[model samples]
Target: MSPGKTASLQLPSFLHGTYRSVQQKVKREGLRCAEQYRKEGAFPSPRQLLEVPLGEVVVVQGVVDIQHERPVWRLYMVSEVLRDVWEALDWEDSSSVRDAYEASFLETAWGALFFTLARMGAVSAERTARRLEAVLRFWDPLECARYLFKKPGAAQTLEELMVDSCGWAMDAWSPELEGPVRARLESAAKRMERATREDCLEAILRQMPRALAAGHDLKHRQVLADPAFQRERLTMLDTPSFERVSGACTSELLEKLYDWDHELGLQ
Candidate 1:
């Protein structure tokens, strides 16, 4: 079959220069370029590529054009991204997801270091990045776990793997899992100092009482013990006068707090 036609995107005024030629060249060598890009770790998801308008003008050089040796090439690239996302949804393996999260952390850390050192005039961005890269060369996940958690859990959570990568670690909690979730994650960070991928996985399934206890202890102090931390302030002092409840409201609130007796442990 003949190769697919070169698809051109309309460019915005800002992207008027050389974009057409670039797209054509990119299209002409689409498969080769894709392979090279993957080898160099430029994994643009197929969904992301398709989001680009084929003939749209560039507001910021924004357009999506794809030329494939065969339609299957486009299909294949999309399949990979779908596969990873699907696995995450299924809560399976979860390693690739962890890896992506870890990589993001590294990017944040590298960026932060780059700016900090650059501002201090201590090192060039290039040199600072190089040094960070070098440091990561000898970085081992297990060693990190052991160091961080003196009483490390046998298993680390998905976020624990990204402890060194602060950005990824920061994102480990979802809006749904924000409270006790953080304490569990901190526990994972502690584990990362010593545990391996295998060790970490095993520990979770075992549900080590020690691990849970440690996580709960941390969470109590960090998230729950102080009512101040749990209570949401609805109004400001300057806005309105609020009624102070001495009896009924206080009693009701206390009952609600301990209502789920046994389930409190699970929470």
Candidate 2:
């Protein structure tokens, strides 16, 4: 069978339900962790726990024989570090901080699981394509830029929005800091606009290393002394480990999605 047809045939049963199940599992785990935090007097309100964001909910199943122990440990450790930072900020009592931490924890745990599953061949290409589409429906860069810039009616694709955001960042007051950041964002934006969905997935993967490094630095900082913690926290989002998985799975998924779109002849 052709790659596209094979992918189309491999769609998992009830894609929405599978996604929701993962979300619920993450939520339950978050609540359990929050209760532990409350008992330790680190987290004040259980009600502050929020649902995981769509952008962080990648779907995969089964298990890989990867060395997940370290990644899992790192995930919770980052959460602990964030909790400390929140407390240091004197924002421990704030519901917003709690909510953000809850979401972060869920994303970390689930994201690790996802990469492991992907390595194990448990991530179906068709299902992944479907899930990515669903995620992008709400969390696409275009939507984010619109919300950030307060331009909901802006006539721009996600690629354009990304480029514009990069350009806007170039005007930051700190040239030393902003220069590199702006350069990276501009380069990434250009790459991402090349093939739309496929490039977007690659961009997401490319940013993972930077995000992880930022998280590690934040983890080591003296929360009380670091004035950059807040700004860093905004960028240190979402993780994971697995063996060398074939990139073919993701490539096929993207191709299948493109083919499907072409079939529909959508503009």
Candidate 3:
């Protein structure tokens, strides 16, 4: 019910005009405006929306002015976002959580993407975002994971939390799972190639692998590379955060693309 009407965020003096236009777009399209604005390569202001693989599309849209719709509308919209996120996951069909993990390389990455999409509009959690102030403060996306979820042991990293929640991080990967696993990986590569920036990062990182198992299926479809090769970094899926090997990212998750011990395959 008039969702965009609630988005009266404070605009800097220069962005007043752009914000007005964005408002109109949001009004017409609701959350669907996220995709349109993404294509325009701007958010509340002019910013590259599709450049980063892990950090794409202005993440949370700096939601100021916590104006939510009526109770029923808010509830329904929340549920819709849940359903959309699940389909967005598009996890290869699996009989067990362990099978699901093997089918999709980023079992934990799926968790990260899932939480971000779910909290995209949660005002209370946004209020509690851990302030990273040395001199100036900013939102620490990683730290906020547990705080936002209001669970003490949700995780040090969202991926870990997701692994536990989905029970998908099991070390039960096997040879029989190869077909579906490669299918999901190729699917991820295809999405990165298209790079429509619809759901942006949430759409790509779930199936994204830490390493390439076999490029047999991927030799042709990576549309973003010079030879139209399969690579995530050259595309919008490339984010600086994904490159770093901190406590946030698992060691195996950063192995060579062709490295098979990657959690989804060998682990």
Candidate 4:
């Protein structure tokens, strides 16, 4: 009985299987580039995710031929490639502006496109002013007035700051959109919903790691019995098949699995 060496466990790898087969072939090349923008009936904008190669086209021979597509149907191709790289995607574009000499252009992709346009809003008001004039074409009006007055309470104020300042002034246009912009004078802004909801729930628990991988048998408990994931047992195993649970499971254990299931009540 001397053969018991069970201690070499190097097994845990699926952190979204290398972008989950490139996020399911970039979501089938963003639904066939959104059905060729609904057969030219329009509505697929952001310059059709940067024109050509509809979906799964990552042709980088020159430098960057990127297009992973789809954040709500390729949000105008991620708002025109972040408005053609908003001053080099400025989240205060680093190098600490040559250590405060003051001309760097702030990037972390404009602090992740200003925390995704301060959590965008407008269910109405003429369809959120035509989706904030198609998301301010791409942003620049004095960096959209320092991302709506340097982040007070980090978003959800004054029509989500006029639909993220008219979708960052329809893409880009700056003569510093001048006038009475005093309210948000940068007291070290940034915190838009706890850093964009923990960076979109850590990119969905690093692309789903099998509901916390121990024994692994939960192949989506019959779609969690389906009362829309029962009022929150920590967001009732957040679907796409029990998205690898354990994100520290509590919201009072998702309100006690909403009284033990009416199909896990997502009330």
Q: Which candidate is the best by TM-score?
A: 2
CA deviation > 4 Å runs, candidate 2: 1-17, 41-92, 99-167, 171-267
What is candidate 3's local distance difference test score?
0.26
lDDT of 1 by residue, 202-262 (tens): 3322322222233332323333333343232212212111111111122222322333223
Worst 10 residues of 2 by lDDT: 239-248
Candidate 4 per-residue lDDT, tens place, 144-244, comes to 22112324224233233433443222111121234322212110021111223233244233322222233233334455444334323434444432322
Ten residues in a row with the worst lDDT in model 1?
A: 239-248
RMSD of each: 21.7, 21.4, 19.4, 23.2
- In candidate 3, where is summed lDDT lowest over 10 consecutive residues? 127-136
Assess every candidate by TM-score.
0.19, 0.22, 0.20, 0.18
User: lDDT of candidate 1 vs native?
Assistant: 0.28
Q: Candidate 2 on 239-259: residue-level lDDT in tens?
A: 111111112233322333233
Cα lDDT over the full model 2: 0.31
Runs of candidate 4 with Cα error greater than 4 angstroms are 1-75, 79-267
Clashing pairs in 3: 53-237, 53-238, 53-239, 211-257, 212-257
lDDT of 3 by residue, 202-260 (tens): 32233244223223443322332221232344243334433221111112232323342
